[model samples]
Target: MTRTVLLNNLDHQDLRVITRRSAALGDAVMLAHTFPAEFRDLQAHYPIVFQKSADGTTFHPVALLGLQDGQNLFLDESGWTGHTLPLAIEREPFYIGQDGDEWLVHIDLDSPRLSRTEGEPLFLPHGGSSEHLERMTSVLLALHEGLQATPAFVSALLRHELLESFVLDVEHADGSQGRLAGFYTLNEERLAQLDGPALAALHQAGHLQAIYMVLASLSNFRTLIERQNQRQAARA
Candidate 1:
């Protein structure tokens, strides 16, 4: 259950949010939604891929964190090991909502991260925004803007038929195998076959770099498999 309400210094003056990463805090997931604006940072740490909405109407990008459900390979007792956390993961317990023509910050009152005596304070002693609050606001703003731009990026990919379905089969050291499917990836061949004008158009829109980032990110799948293997060995 959730009790989401518009944030205010008075009502939430004493609120503190736990900033640590852990599965108990809802960080155990196989993937996190990502946007083109974040591709560069994400490419270095995760395999970027695409998944269709449940309704099969549209596509969105995600940073793969594990091979199986309810697993996050980058998470450990010390916290996330990735070079960067996806904005979707970073903007937890707070969301942006529209109140008429204005955007307002909303807080999840039921979140386990919330507390009164521990973690980062949301407001200063004088009831003003604290540094932590300011940083969270910036994260929320960037996430909002990035999500607003995602549709155009997805549209561009679809218009060019650059998305292709793929299946990955993995074999662990224990001779166990796993298969991942129902995801899409950039079609390098189609992208390469584009004419000069098409290439120039993609470049102008700044999607060309994002596309390559997605391609480069695929290399990290090897890293993910290695993490999975290590986990398996530990369990054994």
Candidate 2:
């Protein structure tokens, strides 16, 4: 079914929908071809391509986009993942279709998960730094630069406990099994003790920016997390 969503705050103006598409080559690293398509509404000038996935699917919506879809119809369902959105696109490609006098951009949403990461992920120590705010700033810049280049990478960093020191989860093409690269919020352990208001307040601030900074400098996320822990330990 063709869905349309209202395009907002972009170089173009139009309504669009989040349609699902197939997967292609580059997507193999980060995604599983299960639901290889995502939702995108782009302009006529945008270059759309129908990539051939590992499967026989000829058309897929794995293109990196810069705008958000108005109608968010494809959200999480049942026990699977909810709202499989794109957090990053290694490259930008779309499916261009000419309909009557108007041009339409299209993609299918059935892409699956990447083969490399089929099992459950094991937790590891973070190594981001705080002693060097300059380093953090640099990392933040890089993440933003990366996101800006990839039209579909929706990113935000946070600076709150539970949602602190670590944030910014980018979407991979893993369908329901995609990982939030260089980012993570609260873990299963903190679920019950989590504070909702504190988290909301951080969001109102610039926590998203903080987390993205952490992602850009994921090489140092562990360091950052360690430093935060040390500070809390001293305070306690």
lDDT of each: 0.93, 0.28
With candidate 2 superimposed using the best TM-score fit, by how many Å does residue 168's alpha carbon deviate from the native?
20
Write down the worst ten-residue block by lDDT for model 1: 83-92
Question: Which candidate wins on lDDT?
Answer: 1
lDDT of 2: 0.28
Question: What's the CA error at residue 114 for candidate 1, in Å?
Answer: 0.8
Residues 1-236, model 1: lDDT tens digits: 88999999999999999999999888999999999999999998999999999999999999999998999999998898888988889878899998798888899999988989889999999998988888889889898898899998999999999999999999997999999898999999999899999989999998998999999999999999999999899999
| Residue-level lDDT for 220 in candidate 2 | 32
Maximum-TM-score candidate: 1
lDDT of 2 by residue, 110-184 (tens): 223212233211111232222222232343344344333332212211122233223333332232221222213
Error of 2 at 40 (Å): 13
